[model samples]
Target: MTGIASHPEIAATLALKRRGITLTLLTTAYFFSYMDRQILAILQELIRKDLLLSDTQLGLLAGFAFAIFYATLGIPVARLADRGNRVNIIAIALALWSLMTAVCGLAQNFAQLLAARIGVGVGEAGSSPPSHSIIADLYPPEKRAGAMGIYSLGVVLGTAFGTMIGGTVAHLYGWRVAMFTVGLPGIALAILVKLFVVEPPRGMSDAQIVAEGQDKGVIPPLGDGFRTMLASGPAFNLVMGVTITSLIGYGHAAFGPSFLQRSVGLSMIDVARYVAPVGAVCGTISAVGGGWLANKVAARYGLHAQAWLVLALKCIGLPLSFLFYASSNPYVAVPLYWVSLLFVSSYLGPSFALIQGLAPLRMRALWAAVTLLVINLVGLGLGPTAIGVISDLLRPAFGEDSLRYAMLTFAAATPWALWHYWRAGVLLKRAGA
Candidate 1:
């Protein structure tokens, strides 16, 4: 045994059964992460009423407060992942965030809740960068897109379960109980991840190096990672594209339930019931399909395929997002929402794959952290807050229908995001050629 396969723990992970198990466990951890992050969206209304909070404040809690620390801290944590045990980092993050999420149930005032949410963000900062690095090591370049796509399914599944479970529990036992219910399971998940998942040597999946028993690479300095990203036009555009996409996606996610309830006259439970299943099914299909399609295209046409695929999806999805918000009838609007979501959500796997593929092996986690920092800051930090402020501004004119139009206003960003994706594709194609 040599390289990654030489380590006793990693040797077990090389077995097909253990590899699949690791992927499943990591995906499950991701599932819990989103559930903790997103449960607030579904329960925002209840929380607003109970705590006497405004939509803007709620948005800050959902978006800015969490995103601020999450984004800022991710870079350093990812630097740790580059040189340390990624599995340990992920497990510790899972436990910390989960504990904070549970603490949210104990908050009696706005300040306390905000503090708890910030703690949750700090913990979650450690999750994705390491997970992405680990996944990149597990699968070779040719198969990475699809593998990433499968892992991305955790987003939709977590959102779905969060909405459904949070809505139902909140309706019955109040939002506090819903928070507690969703947060505790992640602690157990963390323990499992720490015990079972083995860290593969960096660049283990790069065939040329791995087969020659030289998979390990020196961890580049943090500044070098930033320079690598800044020098690559395609990578920068991809980051911009993802950041904009996240803006629209997070804005819609944060406000969509409220819009449906206010404009469509559905209850919170009704919104969850209808939106969760549709979003779950469509998001899963689109995420996996996008990765599979990008892989196939890349196989034939080369490195730019994922960016091209993302551009196409955004183009098709943008108009449907407008229609989804504009329609009055729930039946018509919900189906359109599903189609729009499918297109928007499809980009994750390909986008992550592109980021990892383009990055230097030593800098992959750091680059991922930097990309996430931008995405969370621009997207998660501003998206929901912008919608909330806009909705409040339009309330005088549109009354209860204000949220609907505000979402539509945000939806217009889709085309702007599409342009970035197109630019990214062109840059990638030029670079590859």
Candidate 2:
């Protein structure tokens, strides 16, 4: 027998060894997914200049066009995850997206680049929903926020690696090569996940007190789980809140590199070095710490954790958002942006964990996919495009300052998002969640 099979428990000191391994692989996979997606934002300045693209065109690529396919496909893929072998599907997606990323490096024109990005969108459509499903299967309710928080770390770390690497390489070699560099590594990692991460028993991460009362080894029907979430007011509110927040978040994502380039006069390489790492570190801290704190708060105050946490963070973040947009100094704006990211990044893990806790086992992927659909359609699909359109419209009058105002306008969406979270908190109590 192999070492793992021979020593089923592996090390005595390690607790929930299987869960640790599963989540690690899932997070790493997500790291590459985010890495490939984010590299473009870091390299935007170089790509825009070389392609001679308009802001509107860039926004379309970054926002609506990519997100349209990405969000639309997620549901079907998630439905497949509910019923089929998730690992094989995820591995295929990794390979497809990695190849598409490499293809992006080969584009010589705006149209070609747009098409390549769409390819990337199609490939990425397969990742998150299945991973969410898998996570719900591996860890228990109490551990989920921490687990998802660890998983959420991939967003910042991947962005850091992608941005820094893409920026530096683009600085040295050009943006094209940077695209290829960030994407190719995921192909290998996909194979590793398929080989090592076996699917755990469904609903293992649920409230085990409930699980213990039921018959062992029964996989709940996927439809039943979907209906559970569909009827959940708190869950629905949380999804909408996150989706709205994502709209503004994606706007920042679409134009942040360009903001630094036009406003701060940093070259692409400087963005990777100065901007990417800063956002990455802050974002990771916010995501992981937010989950940890949410759990701590929940233990004390119950489901009210996210409500208070989000309120405090948003109140602080709103001001930082203003500062981020108002400041012209990279030194000031960069750090301020990082601070804002800390708050924004914190939402994902806690929010996702909340959804997992609310929904039944089989439907976890479906609900995740459903949330992604709304977020991608409304948030990513419109945020960048709206900003771009507005910026272009303002350009004749405001000139270079147009982009700044457009970004500030999008930041206004945060308050509404905060309100939704607050409402979700109230509904959570009503639902007895």
Candidate 3:
């Protein structure tokens, strides 16, 4: 009631309007980010055939090499976001990553391509922290989960569009052309974001942001803010839980095209045409719907909506993810993949919303950065590479079926992820709501 304006419904509607715009911009930025990152996956076989690289080498290129720069740089940039202008940071990052993505098309050697991917990663590291901070300022605590979920649709939609387009273009023209095509559009979007999106005053949504700061002239240093987050039991559990879940999600996302190519016997174009679009549509719906459901469930129960939402979604996802991983038929596999995407992807919104809700106004970016550091390092960095390593190791025993087993093993981790979510929920309860 305090934060709401004179006309109660009008205030709520205005809040939704602002949050929607923020989420839209964030999602669009993410769409380009993923497309640029994944153009190589659609082109994997061609890159391998043309570059004459092994699976292990490809894994490194896909996983650690990119993750190294992406994860490491997130903290420092996040620190800057806490202290400086986030929109400006995102705009520059967009241009840098986009230009590098286009440069990927020009690579003739493995090293050049690797360098280009590294550049893309470096640029991308700048995106999340600032975006997270912006979203926290834009939405109230109760709405954060749904808002974050909507924002995260960017991941699903981005992957869908990237794979769809990457596969088609690579099929028709070549992989190089596909990379250039996706990369160029982002530069323009970057300019638009810079020119149009205004950074709202921090702590506009929640009463807590101002309580965390602005009362005292003292600005909490980035390290102190990070330490505060790490000190919380709920925060620790939540970050770990999400990281584990991400391991399965990112790993699958990375190798899916290759799996289709090798096992399902779909060409890159076919993967693009069929799998990508389906994934995008399914994933977006699941993500958005999950948030809506979480908010509804939490609001009704008067509980920590985020914790309950994640627990429910992940519980549902564990079994579905296994079905998705094990299915051999493309018809069965594709639809099941959506269910899996829904379950895993749904958590992003709630988790992010919770983290932002708990964080100090000045530390929003830092909190996002810290969480990303753990998530990307453990999830993105290890997830794909671990699967690749396992697949290669098991190749002699499983033959072409090695990937199937590897995916199943990864899927097995989901139950454990759910356990962590439950633990986080308990901690949130102990933390006094």
Candidate 4:
């Protein structure tokens, strides 16, 4: 036989290997990014009690403070990712967010903790956009959905580990200790990423260069990114759909542990022990499965398949979410929550894959940043805060049941988001045709 390097099959296999390594490192970084973000949800009760704060204050801390910085800073960071070294950007960001997360453990007051959380957001701002751009370069359109689905597992795994580890550690030690434990590991992960992850050439996976005949050496103006995205109907609709979904998802997630503790009469330890695992498994199945199914469907049915799947999943999830919070028994409510999370979690991979597929290569990172800007600002920034305000409003009448009702009320908006997905799918189908 000829030398292994001279064989075409061997070269293809090696390329796949490099892609796998890049995806694995990026996904791991994503895991820590989300763990640091979601750990606060599990520990909110402890923080509130220790800090002597209200639910509304806790909501602001969980939602607005982090999201505002994350969303705003994402644009500039994404610009940097587009023009400079994405690997370096991600590594430095991972280190910054990880360090800030550790500093959260030292907070003795609300202001200090809030500041640290914002710092975490600022650091995490650099993570997803660059990662998305890199993944798009590594995988061609046909495989991107499945690859993105795998990457989206960071959401499920992060939430799972955050709840499991944070709750267990807080129960054993304290919330501060829990934060330190989860936070410090990411710094080392950052160093690993810098040392090992290789950056691919932009547009390497695309069938045609989006910037054909343009200077590959020069970065396009920032406004060019916005113009390109706004000019695309499907891209705009995808952003709207994702933002609304995020509002509902983040709101529910922010209050879910507390809801179980208060509504189902479970202790924090119990919520972590039973509910966390169920939610994690359900979310992982839905995210990975949805992406895989979408890719298979898209292979036959075309680009609209992903959007149609999202629409269907949202439609099914709406009633399930209502049922989950409405039920009083943990046995009944937990299963319902699992089903609801399954459907809702499916949206991330499909939505993200669609964004990358639709956006031009030069604009991919910026588009991702813009999508996140709206999602974080409206969804992450407003969802928890809205729940908090509504809960406080209903508290005088419903007492502890207020949060449950608040979450249920937010679930009503899921159908609204489904409409956008439907519209987006129709547009995508037309564009493909």
Q: Which one wins by TM-score: 1 or 3?
A: 1
lDDT for each residue of candidate 3 in 1-433, tens digit (9 for 90 to 100): 2334445455445545666665677779987898788777778889989999766667777787888899889989998887776778999999999999999999998899889989999999999999998888777877777878888887888878888888888888988899999999999999888765656655667666465666342458767876898898888888888889888888887888888777666678888887788678778888898778778876776446467678887787777777877777878877787667766678888788877877767788888989998888888888888888998899999888788888888887877778778888888777766
Judged by whole-model lDDT over C-alpha atoms, candidate 4 comes out at 0.88
Badly placed stretches (over 4 Å) of model 3 are 1-19, 208-217
Winner of 2 and 3 under TM-score: 3
Q: Work out candidate 3's RMSD over C-alphas.
A: 4.2
Q: What TM-score does structure 1 among the candidates reach?
A: 0.95
lDDT tens readout by residue for model 4, 1-48: 124324535544554568888899999999999899999988998998
TM-score, ranked from best to worst? 1, 4, 3, 2
Once fitted onto the true fold, the runs of candidate 1 whose alpha carbons sit more than 4 angstroms away are 1-17, 209-216
lDDT string for model 2 (309-381, tens) is: 7767877889998998989987788788878888878888888888877765557788888889899999989
lDDT of 4 at 109: 96
Q: Against the true structure, what is every candidate's RMSD?
A: 2.3, 3.3, 4.2, 3.7
RMSD of 2: 3.3
CA-lDDT, candidates in order? 0.87, 0.80, 0.80, 0.88
Q: How many clashing residue pairs, candidate 3? A: 1
Quality of model 3 by C-alpha lDDT: 0.80
